[model samples]
Structures are given as C-alpha cells and as structure tokens.
Target: MSGAFFNSEGISALLQQFDVSKLVELSKKVDLLQVIKNLNSMDDQQLAGLMKVLNAKPKNRELPEIDGDFYDVSHTLTPEQRELQLKVRHFMETEIKPIVNEYWLKDEFPFQIIPKFRELNICGVTYDGYGCPNLPFLMEGVLAMEMARIDSSIATFFGVQSGLSMGSIYICGSEEQKQKWLPQMQKLEKIGAFGLTEPEVGSGAAGGLTTTCKKTDDGWILNGQKKWIGNATFADLIIIWARDLDDNEVKGFIVEKDNPGFAVEKIHGKMALRIVQNGLITLTDCFVTEENRLQNANSFKDTAKVLQMTRAGVAWMATGCARGAYESALDYTRTRKQFGKPIASFQMIQGHLVEMLSNLTAMQTMVFRLSEMQDEGILKDEHASLAKVFCTMRTRDIVSRAREVMGGNGILLEHDVARFVADSEAIYSYEGTKEINSLIVGRSITGFSAFV
Candidate 1:
C-alpha cells in the first residue's frame, strides 16, 4: 500500500461508512498529514482492524428498491398527497422503525418522539375546520396505512388521538367545543383519549353501556370504568361516553385528566400493541360542566357516527399491518436459506407470499373505495362495517402466513413479524370484532337484526 492509495475518493469512501458530520468535525480539528502518516506506519493486521472499524464496503452496488404497494395504489394520490405519504413513510422508517421493537419489548411508550410526531402535521387530516389540514378522506387512510405499516401500536395511538378523540369532537361536538379542542389537538399540543369500551362492555357498547351520567346542580356527574382506553394513562383529556340517567341516551363528555375523580391505571402484560399506553380509567363521580358536554351527542346513534368513520380507519390499519408482515416475511424468505437456496425460491414459500399479498391487495382496494365513499358523503355504517370485518379477518390470515414463512423467527419480536402477529390479534378484537361487524353487515343486507 502506498500513500497514493489514500486519495480523495478512497478517503471519501472510507468516511462514508461513519457519521459524515462527526468525520467533518474531526477533520477540522485534526491534522490531515499526521493522520495519513500514522496510517502509513500501521502493520497489515492493524490496517485490517482499522478498515473493519471503518466498515468499508464495495462501491457502486445497491439493492433493488422494495415496495409493498404492488398494485400502485399510491398512484391514485395527487402529487401533494403522494409527497405527504412518502414524508410519513420516511419518518416511520427513519425514526420509529429502529426504536419500535425495543419499546414493544419493554411495553413502554416512546414519549420523546412526541415533538417529532407533531412535526408530521397529520393529526385530524380529514376534518375541515379547527386548524386541521382539511385533506380528503383517502389521504387520511393513506397516512394511516403508512403509519401502521411500520408499527401498529403507534398507528393505534394516532387513531385514538386523530380518529376517535378528535373525530368525536368534530362530528358530534358543539361548534364551541370544536373551536376549543380541535386546534390544540390537531397541533398535538394536547393529547386526547376516547373512553367508550368498559371492563364489562366490548361489542355491546352501543346499547349496553354500564357507565352512567347524571345532571346535577353543579355539573354532570360521570361514574364508570373505561377499559382498553389507548393513550389514557397520559392523555390530557378523555372523551368519556356515558348513558344519561334521564333519557337513557348515550352522551359524550370531555373529562380533563386533572379532575379529582378521574384516575388511570396502566394495563400491563399485554402481548400485543404493548407500545400503546392502554389504561383502565376509573371515573368516580367525575364532574363536567354543561359546556364540557358534547352539545350534539344526544344518543348512541351519534356515538355510532364516530365509530362509523373510525372503523374505516381501522380497516386501513389492518391492511397496513398485513402489508408490514408480508413485506418482512418476503424479505426474510428471499435472504434466509434452506436446502442451499433461498426459501423464497421454494414453491411453498412463494405460495404463502402470494396469498399474503393477495389479501393485502384486496384490503388496500377495499379500503380505498371505502374512503372514496366516505369522501363522497355516501359512506354507510354497513359499508364501514363490512370493510372492517373483511380486512381484519384477512389481516389475521396474512399475518399468520407471514409468521409461517419466517418459521421460528416469526415468533421473535426483533424480526418484526411476531409483533404484527400478536398485534393482529388485538386488531381482530378491537374497533368492533369480526362477529359484530359481520352482524352489522348481515343486518343491513338481510333487513333483519341478528345481534340479539
């Protein structure tokens, strides 16, 4: 080796393996000639060690880009919408991807990312007013898919804030309420949670809410425990849904976190969506003023309106989860060897990959049309329910197949498929399970309610 070998290109390639900024700063502080002299004096073994430390690699070789969107569904988006989609994708890959498994393993929320998350400017992407972006419903679905494609827990947290909490305030809130909360919530300055499902009530929340509310001389009194409330542990405000004692109608109330009667206990030992901060919220005579009550939310029907919109988002989430698992499994199969060849080269593995992709594609198209109907103002409850039922059911299959393709690594969290596999179970159950949603569709199509 000669000093001529340490030319600009060689040095540049060597520095590329490390942090460029740190190398630039060090170059500014150190003497280049002395560094080159020290390098020249090193033995062959010492030079090999230095190269190992530098992580030198061959030049001009790049892996083909891997895109999960085989149908090019993203092409339907406008240039601006596509830009937003890629921006969110980059954020998830660069920021959330590295830390997600670690956080999921510890069952802890990454609170430090809140500031970075606010910069995405995607909260309440569909709503028109109150400082929201006022984008189309399709764009909102696209963003949901992008987020969930990386980590379903982060997507769940976003859905709780953007779809459920902000949506309740937007669709059923008074104008004053929207003006007060939507702005701050859209900016993510104030995180919110939706409290509807109780410890005793899951699919029967529509007509069988045990949480009760009563009007008083001071304000309304709420007494109920809300289970599986995402972001509840640290949410600044929680939208508590309770049935009124006077008229037996469901009502929505904005319960502040600092209320004396409100408390939250973290739900631990969750196998799925562990990164999500689910809480068992206890409301013991939680008092809310008349102004805090959602002026338009008079019945469970109004609450159903919020669920109708959010259930569509849930379908998108399930699709993303499937996409994530399928992509991971496909990549693993291509790299993982069996019988002296890539497992992806095997017919059985290819069949599994094709099946996963088929389900994912069907889900993508279904939700795309579902969101289009929503944007057109013709989205019905049954339409949302059908998509939710089909997509989540298919998602369960896709994730399982993904796990099968990965073999033992599918059960490992670091490999990423296991988290999706576990989280798919939760998705299958939440936002109205498959049975409830299927019944909703069945009732609509047959004109007979079988949900007794």
Candidate 2:
C-alpha cells in the first residue's frame, strides 16, 4: 500500500468519525499494524459498508406539519368541500398575502382584489338563488376561516359582504329586492356593506337605534350616522338599519352609495384591520322608495335574524386569526435558535405551543358544531353568541401567546403574527362584545337578562 493512502486528508476525515479517546486507544493498540493490514485485505463491499456510516451526514428526524387544525375537525368536510377550502387558501396565499401588509399599512382597501374575488366565484355562498351557490352553512364557515387564516381584514371584508349585506337581503328582503341585488353582488360587480352599528348604538342597536326612518309621501327618509361601517367608502350598496318613526320598529333599507343624502367619511388612525376601510356614514334624510325597503324586516327581531346568522361566522374568523398567529409562532420557534439550540426544543416553548393548539382545537370544534346547527335550521341567538364570546376571548389569548413566543419579531407585520394579533382585537369587539354576548347566553340559559 502506498504511504499516500494514509495522508493528512485521510487522517483528518478519520478523526471526525471517532472521539479523540477512541482514536488514542486505537493508536496505542499493539496490533495497530495488523489492523492496517486487515483493512488493506478487506473486500470492496465490506470496506464500502464501513465507509458509508462514517461519511454520511446525520439524518434529520422529519417534523410533522405545523397545522393548527390539530384535531382534524375539517376532516369531516366532503372531498368537494375540502378541495374548495384549499382553493380559497391558495388564492389568499398567492394573491392577497403579497399585498395585504402594504394595504393594511396604507389603511386602504385593495380594490384590485375585488375583481379577483369574482374569479373565486364564492361571494354570497350560502344564499340559494340569484347566482349564489347555496352551499351549506358549514361550507360558508370553513371558507371564512380559510380567508381569515391568511388575513383577518380580508375575512372581515368578506363577512360584511356575504354575511351581513347579502344575508339581510336573503333572510329579510322581499322577493323583488332579492332579485335586484343578489346576482350582481354574487359576481363582485357590486360590493356591499352592513350599516347596523351606529355612532351611538352597537349592542344597544337591538332596542336603541337612533337612526330613524319616516313614512313619507314620496318615500322613506332615513336620518342617522353609522360608524365603523366596513367597505362603505367603495361599496356599491349599503344596507342601512333605522328605527321607524311611524311604527317605532326597526327596518332595513338598501341605500345606494351615491345617494344625494348619503355621505361617508373614511375613518383614519386605526391600529387594527386597517385594510378594511371602515367609514363613518351620515345619512341626511336619505330617501329610498318603498321598493328598496327590506319588506320583511318589520322590527328589531327580524334584524336580529341577520345578526344571529352572521355572528357564528365571526367566531370562525376568530379561529382563523388565532390559527394564523399560532402557526406563525410555532414555525418561528422551530427555526429560531436560542441558547445554542432551536427554541422549539425547549420545554417552556413547547408548553406555550401546546396551549395555543389546545385553545385553537377547542375553538374549531365549537364552530364546527355551530355551523352544523345553522345548516340544520336550529341555530339560535344564544347558540351563536356563546361561540362568539368564547372563541373571540380565546383568540385574544392565542394571539397573545403567539406574540409571546416570537418576542420582538412578533410585533412586526412581515412575520404575520402581529397582523393577526391586531386584527383579533377588532374581532373580539365586533358583531357583539364579550359582555353583550355573555348576556345573550346568560339571558337564554337562566331566564334573566343581564344586559343593561
């Protein structure tokens, strides 16, 4: 054998494969010369097997996917529904994800995405006719979660259109009103906004809506201000709810955006869901013909139906917000090194991750059942309210932990968790607050109204 066979490179490679103590022990062996002779005489196959173990890089134990759907609640979805869920997820990730942060920072709606929404063909998903797919309410809930999982602002925008605006028309509009508005809204040709939350009325809207409408010789004249009206600035239609002056009951009107009596100021300096383009609308005797009135929305109770149907969707949106934050924080912990190892390998980090997953799993299971109830025609006010109260509260916690795990980087928008964290606060306060929703459940369960 040539002396070059045992040169410095060979020795250096051999040292990497063994501990120094083992190498020293082998070096001191009396039969070390015999060991070299044995190596020279070995068969090629034997030497190849011996060299393979020493030369190969350490194999990494593969990690499972960091999916927030830990309990597989979505597994119950039909194959078609699952495919559609993934389709929406892909659209948000590819199209909206790139521009969401920019629009969010600019406090402006991405008008460009509205045309793309037409391509998705999913607006007005739950309504039966007038170009709607009339899919199960469960499908609607899943789609909401899927959209929110990417960006809550987009999800809120969608909920306003599909749930509040379209739902009011679907559940309360006369047949003629439905035929007029739904098909175009379904195609995203006309964006819509729900105007129930007045400047002075939110939870009190059920009884104390100051926005009033009076029967007129010409038409109903609506006068009031609506605050936090999402999509109002650019929406083609705004569904305005006002107290009837003659009857003292709540009624709905489909107000056109360009009405001479209707004006909206874009709300600025918001810290969360900034891309939603929330507006404060002033209606100075906004006149609508009797035909534009939602004929069946006779009182607050009918308007409550619209709210009941949409509040469940808010719970699903909360879950998506939490899911986004949790997944981002989890992936971050797995890759981020601290104290010479991945932070995810630490016990405390794993503990936070598990807690987040546990809360998220609970929220998902609750909404899954909640949607089933809606599809079965059994969903009630307290039923939706309870889920909203619990899920939104837990979402706040989940996002907090998500930010906690990410430390400083969690607050930055590029990491995505910060956006979820900020958007979640809006979800918690909207539709109904924790206190108001709790009172709804409290009134239902104990036969007592705690709401003041």
Candidate 3:
C-alpha cells in the first residue's frame, strides 16, 4: 500500500510520517550537534573550515541589467512612476515585441494582441471619470515613450485609438457620446481610429480638405476618401473629419465600420510603419445620424483643439523612437568586437554614441516639461509643435547614426534598430510635417502666419 501510494504521490504521503515542526527544529541545530560531536576529534584547521562554511552568506547575484537610456532618465521619475514605467516596458517586451516583426512582415494586425492589450488597461489614462486611471500626463507620456521604444508601429496604433480617436470624442463629443463610448473604448472592447488626412491632402489638410459633409432632414451625408488612417482596417469606429458643405467648416462624425457605403483597402508595401494597418477609407454617400455627429465639433477650430492636445503626445512618441535607436546602437557597440576589443572603445564610435545620447537627453527633458505644461493648462500649439519638430528631426538623425554604427547588420530587420530607422520617416510626416510644425513655432515666436 505504501509503495502504491508512493508511486502515485511520492513525498505527499511520506510527509505524514514525520512531524514537520520537529524536523524544522532539528534542522536548526544539526550543525551544532555535528560540531559538538566532532570538536574533540578535529584539528584547528578542520574546525576553522567548518565554521567558515556554516557562517558563509550567499553571494549576491549579478544579473545583466538592461539600460536603454545611458544617462538614466528613469532616475528623474518618482519611485512609483518608475515602477509603472518598468511594468509597461516589461509588458511590451514580453507581450508585444515577439510578434511585432512577424505582423510587420505580413502586413497583418495580430488579433491575438487585443486580449494582451486589454490586460494593460491603460487607455484614457489621464482622463477623469469614465473608467480612466486619471494618472498624471507625465505618466501618459512615459507610457507612450515606452511603447515606441519597443515598436513605433504599436505606438502609432495606440495613439490613433487613445489620443486621436478617443480625445476627439472626449473633448468634443456630447456627454451622451462619452457615456456610450469612452468606457467601452477605455476597456478596448471597441477599438477606434482617427481619419483626418486625405489621399490628395497631405500637409495642407486644414485648408485643403476635399472631403465634405452635407446636412439633411434624415442626418448627414458624407462623401470623402481618407488616406493613411491607422487602425481603420479593423477599427470598430472611426472619427471621420470632413468640411460641412453648407458652412464650409470641419466637422467630426462617428463612422461605424459596418455602414452600408463605407469601404477600406489596406495600403501595402510601406517602407515605414508597415506594422500599422493604414487604410484608404472610402465613404460614398455614407449616412451618419445627427446623434452620431459630434455635438461640440462645430468648425476647423474645434478639430484643431483635439489635434493640439494629441500633438504633444506625438512629440513624446518621437522621443521614444530616438531613445530606442540610441539604446540599440549603444548595446551593439558595447558587445560587438573589433580587432579583439569592443567597438565602443573606439573614439569615432564613442563620438556617435555621445551624439545620440545628447539628442535623446534633450528630447527627454523637453517632453517632460511639455507634459508638465499640458497638465498645468499652460501648453500652447507652439509648445507642442517645437517638441514634435525637434524630436522627430533629431530622431531621424539618431536612428541613422544607430544604423550606421551597426554596419551591414543595421539593415537587417532582426537587429530591431532598422525598423525604427524606417518608422521615423512616417513619424516625421504624420500629425503635421516637420516643415508645418516648424512654421507653427515660427509663427508663435515671430507673430507671423507662415503656413500657406
């Protein structure tokens, strides 16, 4: 019976034979008992050796620590903030990084990631009420930076949902709209997309929007094609912006994916942000009820307010892209050997590393303060535009330097830095181009309207 029981469950049954409490007591004195028994028989050397063994403390483990920012911007964070930042980063690396490249290669969004993303529960982070965390905007910026650090495409995908889409509804949508969407969207039960740019209207979208909406007795009839709409392919709802034909002012609509006239085709073979499922959206006489129309979005001015809010987040995202490239390059240089020494030891290589770090640190500090202004209600369009232009422009330089240091390995997608290098171009163009952003700042400082 004992043998049979042991075969089925070895130690569990045997545990009944011994008094665990007594055994634990015996274990505490075993060394002393042996020492007393052997004291008379052993030499001084033997006693000393035994004493050393019994008193020895465990050695501290030396695990390889990951330092993405060599200057340690993490040190600037509060202990709690840093903890949250690390939590999000680990989630991204473990959950998102492994599958991102495969999806990028196939140009397919991973449906599997939705559950993992929901577990994060970070949507509408800085907003109050409506199932939001209401964390500081700095934390929001940190989260964005952390996401982009691993993969910019994922970051952009999230920005479209959280910043552009949800923000529009939050800032402009009616209280009823907020009650209907923000909570479910916050939980990611329904994904959202922002549609602003058109196929022909690239940089001058504000003045050059060709998409138009006509009001009717029934509702509103929308006619337009929206280009480069991230997440539109799978999004449950898209915030479509179009000029009102009667008023000639921009208005926003909650366009459902299942609408009769709505169509989407994936834009493929992109050199940048390919993991993002950008779609060319076509809405021919798409009927949107007045209830679905955003109540507060009266003109281009209302639309611009939402853009102003999200532009700061985009700047932080650009900084994240630069930080990712710099860290990858730093790690490669430190580990990769040349002539039996680490390439990081070379003076020229050191110069590149320093340059990357300088730009990254500048970006980090700038975004930190920018988010602070946003939280304080002091942020302006110029404040957001300056960071966007500076960070994106610097990110291009940082990623290029990162790739150059890796030699041929830089071009290989497996190295991870190459994707960032490519994705920075899209970041540079989207959410207002570098030229457009610079002009925004230029207009603020000189009090001159340069945007044509």
Which candidate's lDDT is highest? 1
lDDT of 1 by residue, 84-107 (tens): 999999999999999999999999
> Which residue pairs collide, candidate 3?
none
Number of the predicted model whose TM-score against the real structure is largest: 2
lDDT of each: 0.92, 0.91, 0.88
For candidate 2, what is the lDDT? Answer: 0.91
| lDDT of candidate 3 over 303-335, digit per residue (tens) | 899899899888889998888888888888888
- Return the candidate ranking by TM-score, descending: 2, 1, 3
Rate residue 27 of model 2 by lDDT.
82
lDDT score at residue 42, model 2, on the 0-100 scale: 70
- Model 2 misplacement above 4 A: 1-56
Q: What are the TM-scores, per candidate, against the unseen true structure?
A: 0.86, 0.88, 0.85
* Clash pairs, model 2 backbone: none
When superposed on Cα atoms, how far off is each prediction in RMSD?
Answer: 12.5, 6.4, 13.7
Candidate 1's error at 397, in angstroms? 1.0
How far is 273's C-alpha from truth in model 3 (Å)? 0.9
The alpha-carbon deviation from the true structure for residue 242 of candidate 3, after best TM-score superposition, in angstroms, is 0.9
User: Which residue pairs show backbone clashes in model 1?
Assistant: none
